[model samples]
Target: MRLERTRREPEAGMAVRTQLPAPPAWMRWLPALFVAALLLVEPFTPVDWPVSFALITVPLLAAFTQGPLGVAAVTVFAVLFEGVLAGTPCCAGRSVGYLWERHYVASYVCTILVGAIGTVLAAHRTRRERTLADVRFVAEIAQRVLLRPVPHRIGNLLLESLYLSAAAEARIGGDLYEAVPTSYGVRLLIGDVRGKGLLAVETAATLLGAFREAAHDEPDLPSLADRVEVSMGRRAMLLGGGEVGERFVTAVFAEIPTEGHLVRIVNCGHPPPLLIRSDEVSELDRGRSAPPLNLGVLVGEPYSVDVYDFRPGDQLLLYTDGITETRDPHGVFYPLLERLRSWGPLPPRELLEQLHGDLMAYSHNGLQDDIAALTACLLADQPAEPAPPSDGAGGSSGAP
Candidate 1:
């Protein structure tokens, strides 16, 4: 894979992203070579080179950083060096008695055997690490494909999204949002799984997977909501006793009709999404909502849907609390909607960037939690382009 050098960044760029060049291969093998050299200098298998305290230091440090492969390489080099120098006339063959002595030969030979076992152990661990990396990479790629970039347009609305995980190493976390055009309307979902790591991500994946399936099958937003809850309940029941592990997500699901006429909203204990239209910004009416999904908690018959008329150019902003909950220098809560109302009518990408900048500034370049933003705007319809000239000479005389 090709690696790109980072020259500039929107905000703080971690220095680790620009690590120095790796140490030379010979340097990697130096410890092994040095161990082999000990047989000649000590004439004993377990020769204690006070300097070889590096044996523990080097392998552990190398293993911690470069891992088992690096340690294995060093081990191999040591074995090869020992083999070349082993039993090679320590006294210049002055006599057969001295040359054939068991003490002289077997010491290095047994040392070689021990070194061989060590190499085998190190190599095995190295292979396991490579396998883990491959698996993690595949999982990472799957997360990206499943949650591809939010489309620029959804139905009659223009869509923009902002997403950032807590790490450069991970592409996803417990936070997810998606907007898609379906027969029912343009459907959108913004959700946050309970935790901060892989298990939480797995829960989110479960929700999205279930949503995709049920979205197509269920007739209305309420029915679709029930289907999701049912799926989560089934998952919980699968693990023996009853309810699953402690997990929950606050979410908002909305549907915008094809011509941007009506917007349907359903809340599931998630952070209230902001509706910005005509210079007014406020959290959509919460009224009374059920507990988040997967907690074995749900309520209401129809799970009431809040419907609003969405005109062209109106915007819907979906976000996790990470942005709103961000604390400032004196620990005052960030005022997200107030600031958003102040900076009215920003396009989706600019809206996200501006909010991200504000969050960074509020925290003074430190964020205690992850931030994800998805914005959808209903744009006025576009006129179709006129049909092309029938003979290519309508605008200008033939060739002139």
Candidate 2:
């Protein structure tokens, strides 16, 4: 007769809490110290079963609280303690022969085996931990090098820039801004690439690479924009896409002339940049509407750039739609125009910081997308000349 067997449910493992419970510093050290003490007493006295059992606690504690480093250290402490406590002098008439050959050989082997396993386990754990740390370090380096910190000054333009990448897990969606002085004027670009991750980064890089080159040669913003579109189209062909099929980049380029009072602003399906004055803020509206760069379906001519009157003491704030499109829980969007209205009279950097802080506080420190802000404030007047060429002399410019 065959007997029926019953199936049993597997026991659930303990759930790791998001918040790590940090034990007291002294208390954390206690178990390892205790193991060290036992190892010290292990060999001098007759080998006790209790002592080997006690060794288990050190590693278990280290494994939980101190991690791999602590485990390895505890193992070393055990080895040294064992060597000092138990190893006999291999000298004639000093019990060396008896101790080495007969009296404690089996016990010594058993004691060593347990400690050796702990040490090896600890070492393996340490190596694995180090590998993880190295991976994280490399990722952080890539992010730093890829998204370099844009200096506060680009060519003749005094820039105050702010960039905030969403949480690390989000992999940073593409929101890009750059200011470079060309033969034409101080050319500034603010763009948000279609989609995210590697694809978005590739599109952003392609657009900027083309812009930087074209901005110097194209002279007109439309030509530069066309160049960007062509470059983006080429990349989409090479990379193939889900986002490229459904998404497109919105961009705005500004060319600020040193001698002129007017600044050319090109809005290529991009959100209009806000102009902040002493009392009010207004969007730099476009006269001719156009599609975003790299729609691919239709290749169009260059759109005309709008000229804006920017007097001294005026500030231009350029940003991606992330700032304006951020929705609160109540379906209310953050109004950049209104915020700038109340938060004007602030210097460029300070104003951007204030906006950043308010956004964070309002969103409970959670951002769903990348944010890039570029503020250029026109100074009332050029103040004074530098003493000489000491370093990169910039003691005379910027707005108050």
Candidate 3:
């Protein structure tokens, strides 16, 4: 597998296209079609019955799909066409000079008034759409920076991640994950902040930043967790309020050492990671737990790391509670463990893809909360990479 960075072309150098979303071709031409239909039937209709009066609806139709300028142009055309239909001798059996009649003139004035109103509505609609587009653009950029993609392969491990926000338009949320190659091992972190909104985003960012830095410096998983805890505590202190104090992040940290079949994990008030081996799946519960980040002082529990044998073909799955908590129409929670046991073994990416599809189907696309999951598999029979040479002090150091 290969890691690829996607680069977007600079918008400054690109030509500006109409900001309005594309609708059907027939819909955009509906106003013109309405005018044509009126002209065709006007000649056949009686003098007492005038079909051209319906031209007032032309501008309204255009306003739905066209910009202000387009709507105004259509409005003007409709008024002029109404006059033509009124004056044509064959149309509605009217005389040539009927265009200047009091009723025809009234029809022209009313069409103009309606057109003006439609133009104003179109302008307001366009502005609101543009503002929404800008907001979504900014949100997308933030997501890329905060939840950067994990490298497909780190050491002998293959990794994949999936994230979904409960909100329809939201691209990022409190759920977060990251993987980094450290001198100690291939360290991975996945976690979820307690609540939603800006505060939750801030908390997730702080924890990810702390993990990235501490993963390289801290040699053991417990020390790494401690460093992260200290960072979270400092951040909570800076916020300085009771609401901020209520904020806590549930996380699991895993380290696959440079040369070993054993994997170490430190779970802190988070769901246990899944161990998938062949046809059997089991939870990697450490039997005891550490308090979540920001809750160390309140829970006052010391952190501990659990070691488990991770064979070459075994896969590890880390996720937040959102996955299992998703409910169907019957209010039954999704059975993730049971489903995994029934499925055949697949690659990390394909496995997550299937899981994502199943979750969406289970919830009928009505997700109640943010979801995040990361899966990593040890490549079968691949030899571990050689560790970097140690310095004179007997400590190994190199780029992660």
Write the candidate numbers in order of decreasing lDDT. 3, 2, 1
Error of 3 at 351 (Å): 2.0
lDDT (Cα atoms) of all candidates against the true structure: 0.66, 0.67, 0.85
> lDDT value for candidate 3?
0.85
lDDT per residue for candidate 3 within 197-274, as digits (tens), equals: 999999999999999999999989889999999999999889987786788999999998878898899999899999
| Candidate 2 lDDT (Cα, 0 to 1) | 0.67
Q: lDDT: which candidate is best?
A: 3
Report the C-alpha displacement of residue 33, candidate 3, in angstroms. 6.1
Model 1, CA-based lDDT: 0.66
User: What lDDT tens digits, residue by residue, belong to model 1 across residues 259-317?
Assistant: 54778988888787788887688788758665677653544455779888787778889
- The TM-score measured for candidate 2 stands at 0.66
Model 2, residue 285: what's the lDDT? Answer: 92
| Candidate 2 Cα outliers beyond 4 Å, as residue runs | 1-65, 72-136, 139-146, 169-172, 241-244, 296-301, 329-331, 383-400
Model 3 scores worst on lDDT over the 10 consecutive residues at: 1-10
**Residue 135, candidate 2: how far off, in angstroms?**
4.4
Worst 10 residues of 2 by lDDT: 1-10
